[model samples]
Target: MGIGEHVGRNLVTKSKWTSVANVQYRTRRAGQPFPTAGQLSTRLITEAKRTAERSWLGEVSAVVLQQSLRDAETAYRTFFASLKGTRKGPKLGAPRFKSRKDARQSIRFTANARWNITGSGRLNLPKIGAVKVKWSRALPTAPTSVTVIKDAAGRFFASFVIDTDPAADATRMPETHCTIGIDLGLTHFAVLSTGEKIDSPRFLRRAERKLKKAQRERPASRRDRRTGPRPA
Candidate 1:
């Protein structure tokens, strides 16, 4: 999901004639082993429309568009850094030109408000955009970082990281527990192991005829203004 979103957003930027980053992932063939990064890079450059290029940062840029390539790289780096391990991944590669059909959309800032929290209630983000947050339970310690993301659905969501103490359950189990078995049959809704039976209301069966009649009737339509039909 993460890599796909990055590619999709970059594709959008290329549509605006801005720069973009060319990126590729490695996959294994049916009977072949997974390809190495070098092999993937070679394939991408060979098949790409433009010659493979590199930014000052030194990465394959053959098929990348540049509008938000830098920003996307930054976001990707930030994302991996937040992961549990593998913090020292390769630096972001340079951007390259996109094919004519691949270039068509650009990124625009829409009116979206997102929030994040460091811990239980302390909000944190870049540029000191701190605010208060509400949590159902308190955190044990402060969070390492927080990020806010907005989606095309026009909804805003926040992701928070926090260190906390593990919760301990103090409830005791009861010794005198009773178990009951229930059997369901067509004649009775439920029959208990103690010989008790419960009847079924079968509401839908009782109202079947009325419901079918209502569904069969055609609903009245509004009068047509152009045709001068009178309202019923």
Candidate 2:
């Protein structure tokens, strides 16, 4: 699963823990949001099935899935803890799965989807109410997860991970449109391709004397060695 990192602000919200607990309870009762570990295992199973079919390798077993889930949970917890004392880190909250798909290479799930929405487009979350996303680009395949990131600049962005086949026409064409050469000299700023010369304004030369005078006239202090005093 591929993991995409989006950095932005305006996607964070302030919801009380009690309210979130109520929502979780309702979602569990309704079978909306799957448990985090369950979601991870399901995704891993899908990956193993795909790998086994495509490659010479066989399908992965529950052992691999368990280990992967453990590693992921540990990483998640560590990351969450590290966010403490950070200027704009999200508060402690239960992680929610956004989607499930294999995109680039790894499987990713969107965590904190509710708190990571922006703009006015409807975000169809599992159990929580629909949120408004900024609706940038649709994923090539379905996104396994979305990570809402907030940058120091106070911007909010939603990152989606979608597995897709490599593009066939991926080569870039060489530039063949324009060829221009210019020469620069002290007398003239630039001589363009068409042989037009541009003059350079020497602003520093004009202000040199005044700047030198200002620097010279600035206050100077002398230290008396005996008293360890400064005389202005």
TM-score of each: 0.25, 0.25
Residue 160 displacement in candidate 2 (angstroms): 0.5
Range of the 10 consecutive residues with the lowest summed lDDT in candidate 1: 19-28
Error of 1 at 178 (Å): 14
For 1-232, candidate 1 gives per-residue lDDT tens digits of: 2322434544544422222122221121234442333443443333343444422112212223332344444554454355535557654443345442442323221112233455455654322245455555654454454344444433334454665444422233444578889999989999999999999879778678777786667454642356666566
Model 1 CA deviation exceeding 4 Å by range: 1-122, 151-153, 164-232
Give lDDT per model, in order: 0.43, 0.44
Q: Give me candidate 1's TM-score against the actual structure.
A: 0.25
Over the stretch 169-200, how does candidate 2's per-residue lDDT look in tens digits?
Answer: 23333547788899998899998989899999
